[model samples]
Target: MFSKSKCFVGGQIWSQTTRRITKWLKEVKSSTIRETQLQPTCSSPVYCYGPLLHTVQTAEPKLFKDSKTFVDMRMIHSQSETLDTFNKLMEKTEGKPSHEELKQFVNKNFESGNELENATLSDWKENPKFLEKIKDPVLRQFASDLNQIWPGLARQIRPHVIENPTQYSIEPVPNKFVVPGGRFMEPYYWDSYWIISGLLICEMPDTARGVIENFLWFVEKYGFVPNGGRVYYAERSQPPLLASMVDLYIKYTNDTKWLKDNIDTLEKELKYWLNVHTVDVNGNTLLRYYAPSAGPRPESYREDLETAKGNQALYTELKSGAESGWDFSSRWFADTDGSLNSIQVTNIVPVDLNAFYCGAVEHISNFYSILGNDKKSAEWKNIRDEFRESIYKVLWSEEDGIWFDVNITTGEKRKQFYPSNVSPLWTKCIGQNQNMVEVGDRVAKYVSQSDMFYYPGGIPTSSNRAGEQWDFPNAWPPLQGIMVEGLANSESQMAQQLSFNLTERWVRSNLRGFRDTNEMFEKYDCEVPGRYGGGGEYVVQSGFGWTNGVILEMLNAHGDELTADED
Candidate 1:
């Protein structure tokens, strides 16, 4: 549903569309999801309220009243002021009595249908237990630091707190997991992939296992993992990386017994992704960022509504970008305006989503082969081959020598230069002789020297100077880590060199930031390595999990090969 307002796309006035409420059916994990469409009878346009599962408003708090750990965290998010007061109160409250008193105070403020202005859920499990020994100073204690944060960031959900979006079913997830810190107090889908890398390096297999278990629980209960472990995020999913997370955990722990027990769930989850999120392009299906519901996101409502201007399609596309996890990046925009109004995310088919899916297929195929299920293994391998064949046909740009996203509607390739252009190569989708070799070659050529990409510190999200937080000048650890890993897999000397350089640059910033601030940040200012990043809807985040994860991972992966910075 789009507003009656005429929108613009590619310099053409978009056709006016109206909201049509239609009941839809879906197979959610334990609960059946029933979608209720809203149609307006009045002069105002239809403003449908998307159903949220496992939300405080939907579920009864009294159901979990008997649980000792169920401390209604939603109350703290009633308003920004209440959240500020809660954070301050938390500093004074330390014991059981204090916890109970704080709980009552929040309960007093809690009212049904009360505006939850912004639902930024954070769950920091009690205090951290310090690691007593550090054996390697050359590594600069990143692994040790992450290991310390692992326990303190653990959170769990009780069985009764389910928010099933439909009338169909309800599945329960009761497991412990780690958060990515800042306002993200809950587990995120793709963040777990990099976080598990550091967790394995730190030899904290249990915490890593807990993270995967929580996600598998989500797949079993919700049919797929949400963007993050929040009710408001149920509309869409982030990049599908649960298979990679499981691969990391099992590779490090030799936990074949657990893998054997969970292989059924793995296969089912893979089907959930392919069947549910797949886009049909000329009878060949590829993955894309998708959100089932249409509305301004509840979390960023004010901003979303303001940009949407009552256009339902634009609203859904913007929400799709949020699902991509590089939310609000200029990569999703049409041109240099860099305005949110320029976003039309649902139309593009991303390269990384396809590559990552290929990687997931490989993981599943290998897992099946390991089980000696040759027929099933071959079946999955064929599926991988079919999906891989569609990559270049749909996304590769010959003139640009880069893999770009496809505008799904117009069948046109978007040639915006993006770090994700390197993603297909990261998944080892190219080699010496294949046509994809050109893609690898181009990525190698630019990644080594692009000023827009390679900063003094590390690779920023994009070359775009857009003031958005996910754009230039902000170096995220996960992007840097992926570049290092991908380039390391390349056969070219330039690619290999770029791999080491990216790691060195990122490490310089990470080490310097830790030295100056005494804590890891969620993102870095590559121009001035120690400067905190800004320009997001919220302030700069601290105690950042993925930063700590990738820093430790890069150190472990390239530490011995590169010269160690002087301690």
Candidate 2:
């Protein structure tokens, strides 16, 4: 059974409005879990309901300080006093949403992946020209199809009316947006990075801007983008790549005004990181994936409530790991169990999280320098300098010869290899970061391996072939783009070669899959060709937004020169 949340009863009153309140609950007996794929609903207020996390904007939003529970449709302060409320409110409200209503959502008959394939909030429309006369037929056809897919994926909502600027909520974003496909009906935080890439290539710049502006609306209220564009996702964020997203957006449109206007919001996002996500670890202000509270994630309540039982504290960590977007990877697990039950995610200080922070801070520092904030630029640059050094000193595992997520409790390294190791190179902080040029050399070892990291389709989520979606055999677009671009940026020739190889293989697989299935997928099985990827929380999904985006990018970079026209 799929994980479904919110067992809610109707008619709850809040802020002088007769509203429907949702709650996430857990009632587990024996070790078995049962859930429904749910009958399809024609319309929802937000893209999704978690199976229960969907959101509709509130007219008069109330600011909440509890970061433990729901903060959707609210404002959160970036500073400590306001930040304090978020931390506290979150503690009280998490998993308080009704879980009883879930059965009502279940279909009288079972639902399948094919049933949910077209379940987006928006209808597919044609806005841009589809390529017809491209040299490589395979590349041309896939690009044309992804361009067609964007319209069906797009959504538009009204601006949030939050009572204050300090509150954060995951209400439906205030502008037009596109979801990441399949059950992901909301605009996700990190997925926007790749989606924007496809939007630019598709000549749909306006839609891309709408997506960014929608996120800016969130930054305006909550100080950072929520993990997804739903009010419920405000608890934990995805990868910190907004700076990179802005860079990509500007690269295509050169929107200076948007950057200038949002510079302050960008800085506030930095403060969100420094004030909330950062910790003074052994005198260094490094970042960590801190879950909101020691409660079950509203979306994954029953599964979490059962695993790591008798240890709610550890449960919070596990939820935080899911927030990291490498949800259910071996790196976060404690035992040999390959399932989600083995997750102990909060225990580690992720190298990628800090590496992303390194890039974000540096990107902000440079952007401010361009905006003529000299003092501010130097101040942020100093922060980046300290952070870059800390990543090397604290995160780079000398014994493993690559970065590892360090266990916070024992000060021991995770000893597991993940795509997290290549993140520093993506930030271009590898050789230049504390002059650790050898760090690139050490990382290239595993990246260069064929039977391991160098799969024919792309780098599998990681070298470990566990059943998790983020694990090996299943490779997603975000990691492919991240690893390839990071490699291209590296001074090492090996890094550049690997970048070309990664892009070529992934793009090739996308072409073959499009030819076979007439569909683009959320991920691909690296070990198989023209087949759907498997072993995630859900079935192999189609109409995937990021996969379409990154595939366009890879082909654009290497299609004519490197592609051999397998057709």
Winner by TM-score: 1
Please give, for residues 320-363, the per-residue lDDT of candidate 2 as tens digits. Answer: 77689877777677753456666666556788888888898888
Model 2 lDDT, full chain set: 0.63
Model 2: what TM-score? 0.74
What is candidate 1's CA lDDT for residue 161? 37
Q: What is the C-alpha RMSD of each candidate to the true structure, in Å?
A: 12.1, 13.6
- Model 2 / residue 166 / CA error / Å: 20
* Candidate 1 TM-score versus the reference: 0.75
Give candidate 2's error at residue 189 in angstroms: 0.6
- Residue lDDT tens for model 1, 210-316: 77888887777667787876555666789888888888887877777898898878877676666555665544567777664655665565556668776776766
Worst window of 10 by summed lDDT in candidate 1: 39-48
- The ten-residue window of minimal lDDT in model 2 covers 20-29
TM for every model, in the order presented, reads 0.75, 0.74
lDDT of each: 0.63, 0.63
CA RMSD (A), model 1: 12.1
